[model samples]
Target: MMRQKHNFVAGGIAAAALVALMGLAGCSTTAGVETTGKTSWDEQGARILEKNVVFNSSSLKGDLQIVDLRGVQAGDIMRAQATLRSRDKDTLQFQYRFDWYDAGGLEINSGAGSWKPLLLTGRETKTVQGVAPDPRAKEFKLKIREME
Candidate 1:
């Protein structure tokens, strides 16, 4: 009787663990409840130029700026403005790219390639803009590269 009882308890615990593991396997990071109503630009976009960019904190001796980001939506047009400043009085040239991702955390390939070049004055700032090809995109990331 004692051995039978122990076997039954072990079986029950194993069953519970399997159920839990299955539930976790089905969970996803990107899939979730989405906004149904009209979404505003502020909710979708950010003034990263004004808030996030900072001047020289180290020996880099350069400043970064963002001017504007507009017309943002889950899967629509997006824009941004940026500026670069250098105290060394040297001209700076750089390249930039934008990437879009969906709610499921999957990257959407626009096939446009991913690099654009710009020239800036020692204390000048520039504006950049981008658009999403589809409406399913919910997140975006911007990448900057210094020209070699």
Candidate 2:
């Protein structure tokens, strides 16, 4: 009877260890699947410049919000437009620039971009537009910052 009890205890321990290993394996597999899904999503997003607007300055973000962003092909050039609305009750001065990129996700002219001054009145909405310098620009990133 004692030998049978020992065998039963050993079998129970083995079964518990197997269950723990399987749980760990399941968790690792789930993590791998999630990582792959995220990578795929990122790759797909990289292919298209989807309505992405980034504010480089915290003050600018607090003062204004990007209401809309869109792009169009005008002849051979890519034209981009961004609509901004002031969230504060005071006038705000900011500088913005458009950085163009090609289909493979590279900047068209790395350091040649210029910042343009923007004036926003209290509680007002404004639209800014830019045109790509060349026909090779397939994407664009619009950056806004507070003017010092």
Question: Which model scores highest in TM-score?
Answer: 2
lDDT, candidate 2, 88-111, per-residue tens: 999888777887878777788898
Candidate 2 lowest-lDDT run of ten: 30-39
Give the alpha-carbon lDDT of every model. 0.50, 0.71
The per-prediction CA RMSD against the true structure, in angstroms, equals: 17.2, 17.4
- Weakest 10 consecutive residues, lDDT, candidate 1? 30-39
Candidate 1 residue lDDT tens string, 15-66: 9999999888667222111111112336558522212322222333333444
TM-score of each: 0.48, 0.65
- Stretches of candidate 1 off by over 4 Å are 1-63, 67-71, 74-88, 110-112
Alpha-carbon error at 5 in model 2, in Å? 90
